[model samples]
Target chain A: MNIKELHRQYKKRLAKEKRWIRFYQLLLLIGFFVLWETASSNRWIDPLIFSSPSRIFRLLMDMISDGTIFIHINYTLFETVLGFILGTLIGTILAAILWWFPTLSKILDPYLVVLNSMPKVALGPILIVALGPGMTSIITMGAIISVIISTIVIYTSFRNVDANYLKVLQTFNATKWQMFKEAILPASFPTIISTLKVNVGLSWVGVIVGEFLVSSQGLGYLIIYGFQVFNFNLVLMSLLIIAVFATLMYQLVEMLEKRLIKNE
Target chain B: MGFLIVENVSHTYFSKDAATEALQDISLTVEEGEFISFIGPSGCGKTTLLSIIAGLIRPTAGNVYIENQKVYGNKDLSIGYMLQQDYLFPWKTIEENITLGLRLLKQDVDRGIASKLLKDVGLPAVEKKYPRELSGGMRQRVALARTLAVDPKILLLDEPFSALDYQSKLKLEDLVFKMLKQYNKTAILVTHDIGEAIAMSDRIILFSPRPGRIHEIFEISEDIRRLTPFQARSHAGYSPLFQQIWKELERLEH
Candidate 1:
């Protein structure tokens, strides 16, 4: 066949394959909800614990009509974004400090390993008591959770940047600061963006656990409150909301990645 | 006095396991505008010697002098060092990469200078494009532009064209040779190619491997040195020098 005709057939096959995959994804989602609703209605499963999707949707509608869910979502969203930003910013700054002072990095090597291995969530209670059981403590929890890992990962990327690039800069009589700014930081951008993707999920875990402990506000608080009241529908709805927002945050990081590293 | 001098320079690399002597008692001198090449077998520390001369590393012994001033620990010296690969900053635009040295030096970053250097390297009107957008030969040309942008007094080229295809290598050789002569800049090239060494350099220093020491030096005849690299390869004196250097290199490898 002609080249144009063959190309058209190739594109048509690609479109068909994409449609089938998307159709299957939607089918799986709908099939899961249908199965859950049916099992609950038929008393085949413990509806009180599992909670049907319809029941959760009804609870969502009630929360929306009362205009109470917005506050929780807004509070959670603010804390999450602030935590993610602070975590990445502080982590990157710490990494830069480590890069600048190789001696210091070597000295802190054992300490960093210990801190990274230790559970950051275990420190949540102490943070709540120290900073008070407010948004400040929860935000600190979110920021603190991802900070150590981010520092380690980002610092490794900074170190792994091709030494030849620094050699080129050295020929120019570049200062250490210039070397960091021109080659080291720009070269590590891809790693930093990937870490951002990871931090989105980590910050969510931190904030939610903080809310579970504090039990005052946010989606995590809603889930804890639902559990206390035995309203599994509210818990499921809060979980679904968190899932959606986390994916959205991840997508936003991906967008920033595209904007930042255009050359790749 | 020579414009550049390497006097009794030796370097030994110490690690946890062992110490490797990379260069031993290496010394050389070059005039202001001369082109020199170091051709040798692998692991002969030609790159080590080049890095030493560039003042990026302090030799274990001896010193390098430029215009009678010490090289090591002198931050005022300007040297252009190129590697096998282009090594352009991938995140930066072509213009930004080329003008990087000037920006770092706190000099006036003139767009006209970047465009002019790009034009000189035969890559005009690509200021906004990233390094990844260019082909291999084009990226090397951009690298050359970046190196020459700072207008160093001496250029140390560590196999800058070795990564390119033969055709691109030939073209860049001619361009670089012509540009260096036109600017009257001193240059030191380290290469494994005997013919490249003969065609591009006025003097070829052959090095022996394992504790790299200068074994022999061949001075190209005045006639062949007058031609461009491509033409120099076709010149009558080129083959004899290439053959002689090839035999010497083969002997050194054993």
Candidate 2:
């Protein structure tokens, strides 16, 4: 009936349209990869900057045979997963603790802003100096970097919860913990899930940076190594691996959100 | 003490600069099963009075008692309050929302009774449905069910049907009235609509705005509140009675 409502209706229908488009896109992707194999066989395009998809696929085979690909992938995933979990947990707990006390929230607010502004890579050197170069330094610093964003996002959403709902809870004489359990958590769930989606990207940034900084083995190190040797295939392969892992994590967060979040 | 008593109950809202009185020297009593309405113009503190009685607020000075028990500075689980908003938890199914009070109690309840209450509320099929999936009236029904599930001795209603369309409002008022009667609980309704008060209450407490105080009172017999608001609108003496009430409310506002 109204312009906004009409737009909402159109947008609601857009998902179904996109689903079909995505299926076609999948076909196009498979064709592009096949076409790469075909073009390289025919010697049509230079497989330098634009490495042949077939060659990349063969690299995948070689990496698997040598077991180096699994090692790097596992290391990257280990760092990313560890960082993601630790970041979310520490960020949420710290934000909640700080949010409870306005004075502390104010005091630490700028520090978090400063911490968030600091490039995660800078933390890499400090963490290595303190915790030493290994998975611990990488994961801890990465967690620290990504967790701050989640802390800010989830805290803003948690803080933005409706005053009226809080009033209702107050009328119930709900304990602070009860208020958090019943109203705060559920109300902030959508925002928290969205923050998780955002932090998934940040977590990957941390892991890749961590790997590039001091890791013995990881997708990030592999990328750096490929770049050093001027091996375009290895670089592309590592980038693709990171992309796949990040996409999987993003999808997992999305699925969890869809399952848990109410329409509200 | 009456089943509920408000003795010189007054409320003043304090801002940084000054204080504004919302209610002044208000007093009323409701028997155990009486249905009363506080009716007046907007900003007349009708809702404020009901909120006070519900223990949602404490008067600046004065006291309220429930069954001879001093209420201020005490948490009240003995009352059921339904506000203008349905206030149903959107993420929860109807059954979950309805049983919220019981869940908060952290006690074991008879499933048989809960189901029976759902049937009594005329919403047995709603248990599985989420709040957004229901019509506005149905959502309020669940709210009512939730309030009643606590089995409070009294119920406070704050213009709970103001958001509904006329037809739906009449239907819900009739349904709620019948359900309240069956429960045989005392009720205090806050409404700006005089006709609604007259149709649904045994007595009306009118208040003047700008420091709301009791201005007038009306006594209705058993006959009127039994009819639907629409049906009561067409009742014999409805027009002249509402005209007088409308004039009185307007006089208070200006």
Candidate 3:
């Protein structure tokens, strides 16, 4: 065949391969479910000790029938959203201030490192005491990890902006504020959006951990209650719900990233 | 007073690890509407000298003056600088990048001026496109238009065509020469290309490396300036002049 005909054949084969890969992905998922159901029914694994996907689905149906799962999901979603917003806002402001004030940044750098390394769960008892057994403590817990991580990530990316672009403005005698607005912020925007994507996962982790510690009504609390009462199916169901919700939140961030970097 | 004067300017770059002397006791005077090229090896502080004149750097000793005023930390003169890379802000579209200096100065951005400059540089229809969308040559044209947008009295070009392919570089060189002539702007270009220096300059200032100081100065006759760079390449004295500059550069390397 001529080059053009060969090129067409290559493209056709590549498209076929992609379809096969996607087909196998679905097949693998279905096959795992079938194997799991078979094992549970045949008693190869005791369904009581090792709950199957069907058991988890049944628990989900019961929760839906009673309308309690919605409350749990709504509570967790509200906490995560609130924490995400607060963390992003606080982190961005702190990063700007740190960038503006080098001396303050120097003084606080080591402390930030220590705080990031510390197990945030250890602060649960103190947060409960300070904010009481309420949404405030849970939101505070959720915001803690994201706040420091976002601040550091954003500040570093801000500093890493191309120095030559800054010089282009400097030669024109642009002010510090102009340099930040025109060059630094716009140049670091893609990184900021990526940080937002990461923050979705981080904020979700924070909310769930917070719920684990103090909440009476979130997915984390359901898991805790199920474990206490030896109801493995409820625990599995809550976990699956959390997974689906986290994926949805992540997809939202991905959509935002696509919009922000559209030009790129 | 000369149009622009560098009075015994010297510069030293100091760091905690080491102090490096970049330029030493350099003095020159540029007349109004003259094009001068500084030719030297890398690390010879050609860019440092241009920055000093642009008031981006303060020399260790002595001063640069434009129309009898010291140039250090001065912004009223409006020096337009173009670097090796285009340095166009990627986020901004072509027109916005071109009008950046005007924006910074808080002057009303006249779209007419930007359009005229883009036409002059042969990039007329690309105002809405981002910098990344254009070729390297096209981006440099946009950069040139950007520099001209501010209506600077003096232009500093630091190897502006060094990154381009030969054909684009030649085209840009002619375009730049024509634009500078039309605007009647005083320009100082820093380049390692001796042939380019000889083609585009009224005078070529040769410098020695490592504590760079003027090694020699050659003044090209008015006859050469009357022709375009392409036409000037075939001028009678072109080969002799090119050979002389090539020898001088080779001598400096040893």
TM-score of chain A by itself in each prediction: 0.98, 0.85, 0.92
Candidate 2 clashing pairs?
A: none
User: lDDT: which candidate is best?
Assistant: 1
Error of 2 at A41 (Å): 11
Model 3: residue B27 alpha-carbon error in angstroms: 1.8
Clashes of each: 0, 0, 0
For residue B6, give model 2's deviation from the true position in Å. Answer: 2.1
Runs of candidate 3 exceeding 4 Å displacement: A1-15
Q: List model 3 lDDT by residue over B226-245, tens digit each.
A: 77777788889888998998
Q: Estimate each model's TM-score.
A: 0.97, 0.87, 0.95
* C-alpha local distance difference test of each model: 0.93, 0.81, 0.88
lDDT (10s digit) by residue, model 3, range A155-251: 9988898788988898777988999899988888887788787888888888887888888999989988888998888888888888888899889
- Estimate, for each residue in B71-122, the C-alpha lDDT of model 1 and write its tens digit: 8878788889889999999988899999998888777888598789889998
Report the CAPRI category for model 3: medium
Candidate 1, residue B170: the lDDT equals 99
TM-score of 3: 0.95
How far residue A166's Cα lies from its native spot in candidate 1, in Å, is 0.3
Top-down DockQ ranking: 1, 3, 2
Over A172-193, each residue of candidate 1 has an lDDT whose tens digit, in order, gives: 8888998999889988999999
* Candidate number with greatest TM-score: 1
